[model samples]
Target chain A: EAGVAQSPRYKIIEKRQSVAFWCNPISGHATLYWYQQILGQGPKLLIQFQNNGVVDDSQLPKDRFSAERLKGVDSTLKIQPAKLEDSAVYLCASSSTGGGGETQYFGPGTRLLVL
Target chain B: AQSVSQHNHHVILSEAASLELGCNYSYGGTVNLFWYVQYPGQHLQLLLKYFSGDPLVKGIKGFEAEFIKSKFSFNLRKPSVQWSDTAEYFCAVNAFRGNTPLVFGKGTRLSVIA
Candidate 1:
């Protein structure tokens, strides 16, 4: 089976501009997630969805960032008025279930560079 | 809030040398631990995971990790390392209850010189 897929392997935007990233998860996967990884840091969870329903998004920046997993197969994460601090690798992952130990498959992340 | 910590930021060793990377988390309740590896120009992949049972868990590519519940630690190890083993390793944790997202530690970059 194919792994998770993401669009625009790299992106560049100016500060205060808006950017959006897309993710298409593995087939039959029930859970999808969006994470932000700054340089030299681990991936930080931005939002998680279990079949079109948000499971957790407490860490998401409500003022600037938003994500949606409509129809439970694909997802999109958007950041408006992007700041320099928002420059990072946007990773998307998918899993089969919500249970622990379920392996999560990741995509080749979209590396964003905000100038 | 749950958090994961990786002690080493970077490490370098000759091929065939032993390898060990330390990871610790701050959480009182039960957890699921995982070690992920990201090779250069590649996406992240699961090296191994520990949910319950044996403390020592073996993964692909001769990688293994020992989970210590009392110490709240999970350290990845390899008996003999190769140049291909050079990659960034990340430690992550997820709580058993609720809809807690997986918490990841700052990764360790390993360089194995031939």
Candidate 2:
């Protein structure tokens, strides 16, 4: 089976510029997630979508970051006026039911470098 | 809120050496624990998970982790490591009841030299 897929494995943008990352989850998966991994740290969940509806986004910085899963299959994460701190890898993951103990499969991730 | 802690930032060892990586989590209620590994140039993958029953859990690639409820710890271990075992390992946790997002700790990097 194919795993989660993400676009633009690497990206570079200037500070204050806008950038967007795309994710296509595994077929038939019911839950999708976006995470940010800064250097030397584990991936932190930015948002979660269960069939196009948001399940959690409490940690997301609404002032600068936004994400949507249209039609519940593909999702997009956007960052406006990107800050130097935004330089990190953005990962996408998917699971069947997202229930407790369910394993999540991750994508290759998009590495963003904000200058 | 829940949080996870990995005791080691980096570890190096020769091939065939024993391995152990420590992890601790803070959550009063029942929770699920997971260990994920990311090889070089690869995406993150599950090394193993612990939910209930049998504190000892075996996972892919001869990896295993023991869940200690009282201590609130889940440490990954391997009897003998190989060069391919070199990777970044992350520990994560979430509530056992709800559909909660995972809380991960700062990862531990392992280097196995041949």
Best by lDDT: 2
What TM-score goes with each of the models? 0.98, 0.99
- Pairs clashing within candidate 1: none
Q: Across residues A6-72, which tens digit of lDDT does each residue of candidate 1 receive?
A: 9999999999999999999999999999999999999999999999999889889989999998899
Model 2, C-alpha of A34: deviation from truth (Å):
0.4
By DockQ thresholds, what CAPRI class is model 2?
high
Q: Please write out the lDDT profile of model 1 over residues B1-114, one tens digit for every residue.
A: 889999999999999999999999998799999999999999999999998899999999999999988899999999999999999999999986555668899999999999
Candidate number achieving the greatest DockQ relative to the actual structure: 2
Span of 10 residues, lowest total lDDT, candidate 1 chain A? A96-105
TM-score of chain B of each: 0.97, 0.98
What proportion of the true contacts does each candidate reproduce?
0.64, 0.82
Scoring the B chain of model 2 against the true B chain gives a TM-score of 0.98
* Candidate 2 colliding pairs: none
Candidate with top TM-score is 2
Q: Stretches of candidate 2 above 4 Å error?
A: none
